[model samples]
Target: MGSITLTNIQKSYGAVHVLHDINLAINEGEFIVFVGPSGCGKSTLLRVIAGLEKVTGGELSINGERVNDVSAADRGLAMVFQSYALYPHMTVRQNLAFGLENAGMPKAEITQRIGEAARMLEIEQYMDRRPGQLSGGQRQRVAIGRAIVRRPTAFLLDEPLSNLDAELRVSTRAEIAALHARLRSTMIYVTHDQVEAMTLANRIVVMRAGRIEQVGTPLDLYNQPANRFVAGFIGAPHMNFIEGALESSNGTHMLRTAQGDVLHLPQSVAPGAPITVGLRPQHISLSNDQSGFAAQVQLVEALGSETVIHASAFGTKLLAIVPGQRRISTGDTIYLSYANAPLHLFDQSGLRIATVQTEDGHSPTFV
Candidate 1:
């Protein structure tokens, strides 16, 4: 019963507000990750849940118990910070036992807990070594082991992998995922990296400017974004945006790009209305034909498995991801097109317009 709920959560420092009207329900045994750019308040929201920072407004409940007024130590939560907050002078064994000793647990029980956590984290061999003798990953494991011995209702992790190297981060990320599977306790993690959020979380809460932008499974937000902000934010290399206008031709709706190209639309929009077209780079196909849209290649990235071409189309920069190592080079002209790939249309307000268009001018509703 480690579920957490926040109702109209708001945090402010005098006249400056940070978190705004945050309402989220975290289920027990769920792995939830809060992700956004820096200063978006994802960490602040986690701190609010941990009672490290008092909320200026709203109610926080852990397993149906109100905990806004509870002290951090009494909130039944354990936090692993970005900095491995281990005592440098203390051995790993001592670090794991420090909290239990303060809680006045029996010596036998404290020893048993330390053994269990060390084995779970697989740091038994390094137990006698002080923090100074361990690698960054080992120290982080010790930090996590310290939290594990607490056995709290939920684990709050604040960018715990940010300090590790690229290789270490990937391995440690997997370790944390495995730990969650074994523990099955409610866990809330915060990171600015969407890749971490996509891979680790059962559900991701995307935040921006002190408000929740969207919340859903990684694929849910990827396949069908709620708005232009999310459609551009969720994917790697990002979704491409092209300026266009909605037009009507004899009762048929069409999208006319700024480059004077007209595309068929499946839904009718207000005539002469402005809209933006979003296309994922992977969805675009490159061809030698000059009949379609012509783009001037500005840069070519030949990744081993895929080639990403950065080019300019209709006075706008665009990227197209094609398969395999391409022989194309910078300053080359390439034609681009797509087939059956769904296009994301955004209105003037940047909200998704659910209209699927085809080459035959027939309208099919996009799911």
Candidate 2:
């Protein structure tokens, strides 16, 4: 009953287009997260689905029925906003019951639904208090409780945890995930926080500049990004890029960097074609000998369980994350190597180049 499909969905404010040709299929009971930078039109797209904003073009369907012209209140979707949007004059109980009361639901049923939602969200103790009397996290839970009482066809959350502190955000994020597990309802969450998207989503839709960049599972986008933008956007520390060009020497294909370092390529491309090599910080290791590229350490961050090193090699900036305590410090010279680690190759246009499999059915590695 929660299925939604958008075909060629486009939105515009006058001539300023916000969403461009968005086509997606969301199945029942799926937790989908929309992640992108600010002004990427993620929120606008969510509003379109909730019937708050009309699409400039294309079609929207829910449960196999067209809903493009449906009013927001009749769309059977509930939205939780970043601002909480609670009525200041009402208690938590009143807030949860307001919608049902307006819908002419029986008094007994409203009480039952509010009680169940309050208990589920752990906001039972604050049911009698107003939003001003509750903490940020508690108030956020109450906001969610209000949505739960509606029992809508699907849930839409727009950066609902953005107002909480770091620690509270983590706890509240966990609570949201747990709620999804229990209800198994279709949820569409919009966030600029990639960490939240990575931890909570069954599938992530990555958007950039009003266009869908890629859609896949978190690990799929992490391990196999469709482009340089998705690769750089999905990771915490992000991927480091090195400018280079493809070269072939004696029947073997290699990538020769601008700094003159050469790495083996899994497949052969046109010789002298411009390419970019992407390496994740965790994949790079400090070399004990002079066998790897020389780098000048710029900064060092000792983060208890691991160390993050910011360095420059071959005239390009690089970052490496290594485990455990290290005596490394700023201004030290170190060598870095990512031998045999997975590498991502992109063409000059920032599109990923597919890796070829070997006779052993394994993709070749960088050396």
Candidate 3:
């Protein structure tokens, strides 16, 4: 029963509105992540749900009961913040037991909860040590143990790994995922790193300018983006977009890039209509022959498993990812060909438009 629901959620600061029209339903035990750029209102929205801030409009409910007026303590939730908010003078065991003590739990029950948390987080060896004696990862584990000892209905984490080094972040990230699996309690985590959101969340809530742009599973958002903004934001090297217009010859629809390279499309569009063709770096194929678009390689990055080529082709810059190693120099000329790959088309308003035929012989509509 650790569900959370929001309806028409809005927030403001006198004259400036920070969050607008946010609506979502978080199921019990589901791992949800709030992700966006800084000032995009992801953290602010998390605070609103935690009852740390007042909602400017709409209603919020937890476990089927309205909680907009509920105090932060009464919401049956625990939060782990970016900073390891541990008591400097208190030992790990004392810090873990602090919340239960304040809530007036029996001493025996508090001890049991602290013991379980310490064991679960693998911090039993450091229970007698103060925060000053612990490493970054150890302190963070103690912080999480403090939250876990409360046995709350849901957990709210706000960039809890930001303070750790890269290696520690990865390990802690895996630890958190395992914790979610073992406990299966509702968890809402906020992070600006897409990698964390992709690996941690059951569903990701991508926000922008105080608005939710898209909400879906990581693979869903990656494979079927709703718009240009989402397509550009979800991938690593990002999707490369080439400005072009539609052309038709003998009922065959083609997209002509600004550099005069023609691309055959599966869907028919209005002739001479403005359209943007999107190609992911991995989708672009390279060839030694001159049959494809001629391009000059500008740079080459030889990662152990794959090579990334930065090239100028068809009057626009492009990135091509190739398997294995290729002896490609910066000044080498290569032919680029992209065939049998999914094509993303966007109009002037950055909205996705689709015309490819499905197996049922009908074109699907874009979202």
What's the lDDT for residue 322 in model 1? 92
Highest TM-score model number: 2
- Could you give candidate 2's per-residue lDDT for residues 273-353 as a string of tens digits? 998878889888887787667789999999999999999985689999998988998999998877656778889999988
Identify the runs in model 1 with alpha carbons over 4 angstroms from their true place: 259-261, 355-365
Candidate 3: lDDT of 238? 79
Give a tens-digit lDDT track for model 3, residues 1-367.
Answer: 3999999999999999999989999999999999888999999999999999999999999989999999999999999988878999999888998899899999999988888888888899999999999999999999889889998999999999999999999999999999999999999999988889899999999889999989999998777777787777777787888888888787667778876877666544678888887767887777667665678999999996999999987578889898899999999998876644566787878877762422211122233
* Each model's lDDT: 0.87, 0.89, 0.86
Q: What RMSD does model 3 have? A: 3.1
Q: What is candidate 1's lDDT per residue for 213-296, written digit by digit as tens? A: 999999988877788888888888899988788887787777788778676665556678898878788877876565556789
Q: Look at candidate 2 and tell me the lDDT of residue 334.
A: 93
The per-prediction tally of clashing pairs is 1, 0, 0
Q: What value does the lDDT take at residue 307 in candidate 1?
A: 96
Error of 1 at 220 (Å): 0.6
Q: Cα RMSDs of all predictions?
A: 1.9, 2.5, 3.1
Q: In model 1, what is the error at residue 294, expressed in angstroms?
A: 1.6
